[model samples]
Target: MSGQTMYEKIWRSHEIVDLGDGFSLLHVDRHMLHDGSGPVLARLKERGRSVSQPDLCFATLDHVVSTAPGRPVTSDNRRRTIASLRDGVAEAGIRFFDIGRTGQGIVHVIGPELGISLPGTVVVCADSHTCTHGGMGAMGFGIGSTEAEHVLATQTIVQAKLRTMRVTFVGNAGDGVTAKDLILAAVGQLGSAGGNGYAVEYAGRAIQTLEVEARLTLCNLSIELGAKVGMVAPDEKTFDYLAGRQFSPKNELWNRALASWRDLPSDHDAIFDAEIEVDISHLKPKITWGTSPAHVMDIDGIVPDPSSTGHRNAVQYMDVVPGRPLVGLKVDWVFIGSCTNSRISDLRIAANIVGGRKVADHVSAWIVPGSENVKRQAESEGLDRIFKESGFEWREPGCSLCLAANGEAVPPGARAVSTSNRNFVGRQGPGARTHLASPAVAAASAIRGVISDFRTMKD
Candidate 1:
């Protein structure tokens, strides 16, 4: 066969059976479970199923865990969910990262943080953003509850082959432009469904230069682009980031892993089903104005006409007129966390911008780290003090308002500039209007009480 892509390499290596009709049974290397996992495990038990290879499985309480400073379970339903997962994992002999544990946090966040997500491995979780693991050059994707159960029982999943697409973000990303901004620009250019039915490989000078955490942020939104998986080629930066990480290979095994990862990049002669290039040289920090991520524009641009953009309902719900500029749009809430931008780098960038500035009185701002480790690291670096001193709540780590499932949400009809991945209506709460942006933008907006650009803010 001709040269193959990295996706093909990982997939072919893990594929145990070529179940015909375009499907293959692939062995799972790492499986992550979260609060939502409770119900699935319950159903698995109901059918007399049990976990296979418990050592390969990891569980944590996110999604339903409250990220309050005390980190309370918060409600009866959340209490039950926590108990179910807590009890189920113990019975199945799976490792559980319970609340306040070192690994506790969003499954996607802790996977890369703990090194459980390694280069060239197949990682799966019930969360859509599990694709975030691809930053380490792994072939990771989200699975449904049923598929997750299947992996729990058999340690294998049947998947249809996906078409491959390479989205090469060209040019250098300037100051204030982040991985979040770059990926948002792609969603705007390709539309949310752009990568449908395909696995996307992010490449180019820009992607190659990204730090490991930034790559995770970039790959985190692949699902938003309708991609089944998203990955970047592993390189020295990736290797350096993973070296000595908690779960990474050790000593001799480490050298061997490095050798394997170095070979995981797409071959120079490899071909893809689709190739698209985006020039981010002139791009500004992007923000979503409508209900969908595709309805985006730069901080300086006026909103597109609703009829022309086919976002009349979005415009109506967002309460924006066609010709209005995005900057200076009033916002009531500012959230800087999620699987996407909740890494240490993301927090440091935002804290740098918010160091001496106070969040506007009318804007309620919150900064949540992605995992317990991230939370502790930020505290060690005084990031929490910087945020709290500036009138932002430096809260505990969890999904928090990202999913709004733990009873935390932006008030209805309120506007928020958030760093989370999605801005779909009711995503943050019922009738809440959301504008998605990078952590820098979220911080700037929190200070200005409006959709302001961080680039314009002087420290």
Candidate 2:
């Protein structure tokens, strides 16, 4: 018999009961909640079920919460939502990372950073990018509000078994090519719905060489790729990143956890339902030209024909001339924050490029850290000052500008080079034209006031 894939291994361990017909009742090891998750807590209570394991759950504020410095939790709806989760968790004895707390930040960012995400465990959240935890080898996926209530009420969820696909990154990435670019290239090759119903595992030398944060960025976009879950088999790098984190196993527990993590990778003889190889040996930084992530293009490439059925609407909405390139296309905004790319390392990459260079006069640019911890660390390293000197706003952390949910929006008809995961119509704001790219590319675009190539900008 062939060996089991990592997803299969984790799924088998978590199966509490086999419901037959490809479905199982799976134990949930960790639960993460955000501001929008208040409804789930209310629903769980409404059903007269108490939180089954409050100690295993955590709550924080992210979506729809303002990212402004000293931002007030105003508005009846926002205040009520925040209060509901805060009060519910407090009542249930769950951990709450409230505002001004060290662990507070975006849900996906805080999960891995705090070590709530671990290999060989099942982590679920109401946010689609909860798959970000899979960077550490966990079986992570998003759940709907109903599913969230079910997990909280019983510490288990009913789920369908997913077919596994292995995406192998062949050869090394070229300079200026980031994990963001690599995934964008894959989306371009495989199309948006390529991985529908499949649990995708990223492998090969390129994935093996990426650090944990880059892996998080890679898995964060799995939902956009139409995959329910995405993961990298844990290795020494995963153990190294998790060690000493707030909730990570410690001392003797740490040693045992490390031993188990070493066993999480797929065996050499493992078989996948499908296999794909993305040749990134000569890849360049990429940007999204249309609404979907699959509508990607090279830094020096021309736009697709607007006359094409797939592109006509996006092209007309973005107001771009078909056959023309995006370089030197004036940008009105540059956002360098998102669960996708707002970690400390991502900030360093952007600060390195923006240092000693001023943002264009017409470009409104901002840099938001992923969490309070990341914000503090960046300030300690003076990255905030570097950004400020370069005319970039060093703002508080949240899901800012990425979804435009926290009272932030890119003006209608304005062009933005963003580091967020999605470039869908209205994803940023009403009629906002978003070009999704990496932190390096966003920094370069802020300076050039257009969709310029970071490779062309010398430090």
Candidate 3:
């Protein structure tokens, strides 16, 4: 057999033959939908086409639902989406995980955490960060609303083949460094458009050592680097993380699944279209310096002088002066929770930083869980109490500040440190500046009212 990259292997396996125009019809093994996108699927049925593969589609109510524990669902948009999801699931026979349901969370988080995302599967979602599933070695990407409708009707979509990019990170990650930091560093080095027209495969010792959540964090930012998808080869860590999840196989089936996952790694001599290398030992906790994920620097580094760099438009829009210190920069808000870092472990780490701490007098902080399940788990461990007592608002689970979809948004000119992906200008809101970081860093920034290091705090 010929050697191939993991992307090549998976893409070839799912190929349904070419359809011309640089696109090929591809079979979708798993299709996830959410409140924001569920309405479109419902409309498709209104036109008389049933979901071709109901078993292949899953629906969840998240994006606009009230994340407040024990609170009744509110918001007209949310209500409509939830109702449509209910109707769509019933009419289409798709699996649904509604709010308060056992499997409910951010659709992206629910997939891999529940083991519905498996090696070699082709997963598609209506959300961009769907690449997060690539952490389990799956081939996944986001789809637009119209495309979502197509997948709902046929369980297939057309995709252009992509070049493969290999990013190898050697050496141990220094203390306080995380997969988030590594990806941030890589994006910083490569620029936001670096991985355009390619899928990225993360390799080397540092990547191998990352836990499944950390690996997901790495792949989650792949889009920021312009990759269509990003993935890490599944290994023992992948199997261990999936072992007892709700959708994971059990008994002899579990063993069979493990055996298959173990073989999903690329061969020793696999070739990639391009390659990049990073050393994690030199990486630091990163903070976005401009409006993009590529505009980043170490937590302790000075804000960049846009004059020194080439992205003049971004610097002018960000209004960041050249060579100013990023440390002690005043921020209006701090947000934690998003599909990116809203898991239980992410909450635990943020809580450790916020416990016995108080938010700066002038700063407002919002802690939104990624899902109802994450909220329940965090509350059970008293993580919510720590956040509440720290002057942070512990709200219901939803996209919240991540997308400003539920009337939760930072005002214009407000600067914030966020745990969510993307920091593009007006991404949070018009003129609302966002700096992306890990949850620990976001929590610490809230306490200090500036970008601060979590390593200085005691657990």
Q: Write the per-residue lDDT of candidate 1 for residues 312-393, one digit (tens) a residue.
A: 8899989988898989989999999999999999999999999988999999999989999999999999999999999999
Please give, for residues 21-112, the per-residue lDDT of candidate 3 as tens digits.
77889999999988876678667867888789988888887777765557465577667767878887877788888777778888888898
In candidate 1, stretches whose alpha carbon ends up further than 4 angstroms from where it belongs are 308-310
The alpha-carbon deviation from the true structure for residue 63 of candidate 1, after best TM-score superposition, in angstroms, is 0.5
> In model 1, how large is the Cα lDDT of residue 325?
91
**How high is each candidate's TM-score?**
0.98, 0.98, 0.94
Clashes of 1: 0
Taking all chains together, the TM-score of candidate 2 against the true structure is: 0.98
lDDT of 3 at 80: 78
lDDT of each: 0.91, 0.91, 0.84
Model 1 gets an lDDT of 0.91
Backbone atom clashes (below 3 Å) for every candidate: 0, 0, 5
lDDT of 3 at 298: 91
